[model samples]
Target: MKITLIIPTYNAGSLWPNVLDAIKQQTIYPDKLIVIDSGSKDETVPLASDLKNISIFNIDSKDFNHGGTRNLAVAKTLDADVIIFLTQDAILADSDAIKNLVYYFSEPLIAAVCGRQLPHKDANP
Candidate 1:
């Protein structure tokens, strides 16, 4: 399947590299990695641009809307068989994460799937 991954990024803080690295390390790398950056003041754009299979589209921070921005990213990929949306800070826990997610699509009745999200290790319990 042609999987396209989309991530909405702002500053994305200090965890951006880890997020990108995790995606890069996935056993099933996305066919396309779309990054919609909203006028970040950090290295988010440059760092993503340096990676392969990533395409970035710039938008003003003032124009960012959670749902609208994501819809726009989806529109950019008309040929994708599966579209995966993610936040810039989401780091895949293992190499098989994407592979495992994609495996579910083999079932004819499975229309969509969501991966589990865990709290940050540093977050207060």
Candidate 2:
């Protein structure tokens, strides 16, 4: 399946690199990576923008919307069998994480899937 990943970010800070690295290590790397940034003052934009497989886009922070911006990113993809959405803070737990996400589409009847999440060690109880 042709899968594309969309990540939306602001001031992603230090966690973003770990997120990117984890993505690169996935057993099934996305065919394309699209990052939508709302004008971050931090290094988040440049960090992802320079990556070989990532395409970064800018929008005014004031114009950010939950569904709207993501829809915009989806519209940019040439074509994809499946589109996976991830936030900058979502670090994949293992290489199989993405592989698993894409696996569902193998079923001819399954058109989409959402991944399960486990709380990070730093989460407050």
Which candidate should be chosen as best, given TM-score against the real structure? 1
For 23-94, candidate 2 gives per-residue lDDT tens digits of 888988888999999989998988886565788889999999989999999998969888999988889989
lDDT of 2: 0.88
Per-residue lDDT over 34-76 for candidate 1, one digit per residue giving the tens place of the 0 to 100 score: 9999999999999999777889999999999999999999999
Query: Which 10 successive residues of model 1 have the least lDDT summed?
Result: 116-125
Error of 1 at 91 (Å): 0.6
Would you list the C-alpha lDDT of every candidate in the order shown?
0.91, 0.88
RMSD of each: 1.3, 1.5
Clashing pairs in 2: none
Candidate 1 clashing pairs, residues 3+ apart or interchain:
none
Measured against the true structure, the TM-scores of the candidates, in listed sequence, are 0.95, 0.92
Model 2 misplacement above 4 A = none
On a 0 to 100 scale, what is the lDDT of residue 76 in model 2?
A: 88
